[model samples]
Target: MIHAQTLVDAHLYPNQEAVMADALRALLHDKPQLRIELAIHRYQTEDLSLAQAAHIAGVSFDRMKALLLARNIQLRLGPADADEARKEIAEMERIIARRELP
Candidate 1:
């Protein structure tokens, strides 16, 4: 079977990391629920903001919030300060620009 090394040797991808990234992109595209689960996991463990998680999961902010709530994950609420709030806004803007939300 063709593996990451095989693809790397063929120069189809620059490196194993690129191969893994493409593989993950395809897998997440084909399996959206996994993306949501991954986003939730990152959100909980990686200190990712809700908007960032939503972007990663390919879901809307509200939908992500609901998913977290359904799983009994306590929401983190608003940003701690102005800089964080700005970051959150930037993420939200990116989500909106991508039309990820309703």
Candidate 2:
């Protein structure tokens, strides 16, 4: 199999990072389930909200909720504590400032 460095050497991609990004896009396109899995993993392990996971998975918010429920994953509808609430609010503000809200 051709390595990312080989693609870079051939000038097909600007660099290894570009090659990896393209490969990831293609792989995620071909295996759409991977997108959802990745999103779910991030939501479960990271501080991401459900909406963020849905965005990453390219699914509706409700759909992501259902997927999470179907997998028996407990929902974190709102922040569990003051610090988390603050973080969530800060993230929301950042998204709004960037005009990233849908």
lDDT per model vs. reference? 0.90, 0.89
Q: Which stretches of candidate 2 lie over 4 Å from their true place?
A: 79-102
Tens digit of lDDT per residue, candidate 2, span 8-69? Answer: 99989999999989999999989979999999999999978987788779788899999999
Best TM-score among the predictions, by candidate number: 1
The reply for model 1, stretches above 4 Å from the true place, is: 96-102
Please give the lDDT score at residue 14 for candidate 1: 98
Clashing pairs in 2: none
Query: What TM-score does structure 2 among the candidates reach?
Result: 0.75
Q: Score residue 42 of candidate 1 by CA lDDT.
A: 97
- Whole-model lDDT for model 2 versus the true structure? 0.89
In angstroms, the error of model 1 at 55 is: 1.4
Q: Cα deviation in Å at residue 63, candidate 1?
A: 1.2
Q: Model 1: per-residue lDDT, tens digit, 1-102?
A: 779999999989999999999999999999999999999999999879987888889888899999999999999989999999998888778767778655
